[model samples]
Target: MLAPTHYPLEYHDLRLVLALVRGGSLAKAADLLGQDVSTVFRAIQRLEKALGTRLFDKPRSGYSPTPLAEALAAQAQQAEQALARARQHTLGGEQVQGCVRLTCSEAVLQALVAPALGAVLEALPGVELRLHGGPGFANLSRHEADIAVRLCQQPPQHLVGRPLATVPFVLCAHPRLLQGDGGGAPPWIALEEGPGEDPTGDWRRQHFPAARIAHSAHGLHGVAQLARAGLGRALLPRWLIEAPLQVLDEPTVACASTLWLLMRPDCRHIPAVAKVFEGLARHFTTAANH
Candidate 1:
């Protein structure tokens, strides 16, 4: 058997192939790439001819990549990243100034992200920062966020997650709640009912296992509000409610939560994102230790 004649594939052809693989159909890929369907189809055909193999098999569901195409897709992804870095370098290295979108929990935003924003802005005046605060994890692999702060025991695989700090938990209450209570230690207000016994109520059980909860809340913020209202004592992150509430020494529990900064391995080479990552790492590392 003779080996097929190999024709070098251009970057455009590689991009078209990758788009088709991702979009699942020629028409969809065309829409994403802003090209006519015929043009996309022609590009795929040319790619197949050059490689001497069929790249896609059309099915009732959608276009599915063949084994060879699947293998090529991985290579194409790396090539695309390399090309982006090359373009950035060619742009005189000054173009690293731009907006970076970050996602993290509300507590993280308050404790770490908000404090570091000033330094980052001063260093890169052309760069802007947009923060997305929530609990659910953002998909960094898909570029949903340029960076993320999360609490986890293990960092995600294929992504760089550096340990920034270990946040400790503390039991606190409003001053008004403790006025009538004795210094010896008052009865506590629990957050939830109990764990395993009720999945929806486990959050309460986990945080306030000893206290008798005066009010039940669905989220930590609501629970914090209830605590402030003197409803009951609650366990909360020290960094979040430290300044606002009176820390109860008697019921104080030293539970720890790990803080991590997550980013794609490939993104570390992007100058703007890289600089932000470095800044965050330095800021959090120092903050965590202190």
Candidate 2:
């Protein structure tokens, strides 16, 4: 058999194939994979190219796996089981001495996790941090991450953790934006949609139907930067702002996903994971109350 890397199929890619076969449709597979349809499509295409074989037979009803895919899917499930066993084995040392993989949206990492890590790194010199940030939530079940800082009303059913904070988006604008002859609502800086449609963007569109777009950005940090540069008013999460921009009096419920400090059940008891988890919990709790 080819080595794992030479095989070129990753754990997530294998799961995607299984998900597509089981879900029977692109949408359903996307849901199962915790990704958008485009992403699922792209990943499958990439996998097929890597293997130099078409794994799925396409038809109107839905995606159906071929013989090669069936065999691979079986292997994938076996790999998953092996990974679970490996999970317990890999995390045998003190969490403080080993590496911890953390996943979160860019906004959370920059505003919360990144700022707090200085203390964590200072206190535990042996601990290594591998921060993974993106638009999509990483799959804890597949060992994509050891911990996740998620912003959602309810945490996913697969993970377990505590509510770190109620992160609410508030209207904030640079002081210069409010300047000039007539005082009026500053043009809005719109946060653009990602792979999965952001519910908050729709909420903003509905609530402020007439708002003008002064700028647009794909990430919260970009939006905050634009607002700081006096582009326009921006609805930013409360924790993301430190200074220069001020929260406005305008009412907004555009987006309010709770911050959750979560870990896969299988990975949580590791001493190092536990220690870092506790520190993150304390940091967010303090940020929330303050």
Candidate 3:
């Protein structure tokens, strides 16, 4: 018999075993965990050796958990729950502490979420906020981030998501461009295909289907700059465009986008994640209504 501590299985090993059981195959488990098959196999071997029991048996259909493995899985699940509880207690129940990974767009990070989250950080000194800002959405289902702020037409079904607010977009032109002119010809430079798509380059096709682009960029900052330089009218989030840029008073051209907060259903209950979500919701709701 192997001693419990001799070939000890770490928390990750236990998690890998659980993933394998749930996924039903080495390759499937690896895919789920974002790991290679060899890594999953190694973890399983380590876990089985530690317990001196064969946890899984190969079958025609796929790998099946043995009776001993099933029993061990039940125990492991209980242990995992206990550990999670202990972690919560150690941090302070219902009070957020520790690090939280957040994903958002550059404009939101610089203009809204970052500033609002600064208040949260000040309130909770022990908490760490890891912000990832860019165009693409992070994979929350795989634990890529603990919380996400996304602007999307529809939220994914597997995760818990809430509407933060509906942010309005405005068509703005540089003061010089609109000085005595009628905002130039048609075809304004704009954000390419919504927030989920790339926000750079010549995106006139989507916003100004009939207009030609004088310049293009991959970020809002660049587009805003070009518009300010009288390159062309640009579509941008109202929050990101500061004073001096004149909003084109065309009711037919304006559009609104929905902002959403998303989190894995499992992590939604985490105090840290919950606190941030509440704070963001409150801030955005108040801003939008005002």
Candidate 4:
């Protein structure tokens, strides 16, 4: 097999391939690449013609990448990372005027980061913070995100950052639902099973063996909303505690999860990334105090 570099492929072509491989669908790839689905489809067609082989198998669910496509995506990711590092080093000392992409869960964005945005912008007038909210962590090594705020027991060792807050789990529900001891297997609001391991779900199952799951949501944000609606009791981070939802002290929930602010080692020196990093760290740290 000819090496991917041996083929007549442009840098952008490789990026499209990488986006497709990561996204698993034409619409998702287009969204990541900031292109239309038709454009991505046309480009893939052209790329396949140039390479003289099929790169993906189109299935009902999503795009299944061929081995060659996977190899090309790997090379593209490495090249993107190298280019980002080179660019950061070359312009590390320049004014912090470029965009800094920050990725975190929707819950964090709504409860924490979003509230701090105006202050952050006021402090760094020249910088633009692009917020990407999702359940999955963006690949920092691939330059998918400049910074990430994650809620986990321990962040990946490769990333560089500190835990901003120790987030404990809590069982909460609408005030009306918790009129009494709130016992007897009350309805539960559960997080739907996904790609990663879920300790909270396991805790719920182990603790509440006969509990009925009345509602299911993708993440804590949705679970909280469901709890607020008096649908069921939800196990959420202590940070998410708010009005209409009161904590249930009897069935004590405990998980030593921490909120971490992380970034790539190569990004530490970039003025915009550095400034945003410091600002976010301070914001979350101060909030954690109260």
Predictions: Cα RMSD each: 7.3, 8.8, 7.6, 4.4
Best by lDDT: 4
lDDT of each: 0.67, 0.73, 0.69, 0.78
lDDT of 4 by residue, 238-283 (tens): 7787888998885554644677888988567566777888888887
For candidate 4, the clash count comes to 0
Q: Which candidate order results from sorting by lDDT in descending order? A: 4, 2, 3, 1
Report the lDDT of model 4 for residue 36: 99
TM-score of 3: 0.66
Between prediction 3 and prediction 4, the one with superior lDDT is 4
- The 10-residue segment with the lowest total lDDT in model 4: 194-203
Lowest lDDT block of 10, candidate 1: 193-202
Candidate 3: lDDT over CA atoms? Answer: 0.69
- Per-residue CA lDDT of model 2 for 57-118, tens digit only, reads 88998788888777777777567556644664675543346567788878778778888778
Candidate 1 structure quality by residue, lDDT tens digits, 25-87: 777688657799999988888777777778889998878888777667677768866765676
**TM-score for each candidate, following the candidate numbering:** 0.61, 0.59, 0.66, 0.72
Clashing pairs in 3: 187-211, 200-217, 200-218, 201-217, 201-218
The better candidate by lDDT, 2 or 4, is 4
Off by over 4 Å in 4: 3-8, 78-92, 96-101, 116-129, 134-147, 154-162, 180-185, 195-199, 251-253, 262-279, 282-290
Which candidate, 2 or 3, has the higher lDDT? 2
Q: Which model scores highest in TM-score? A: 4
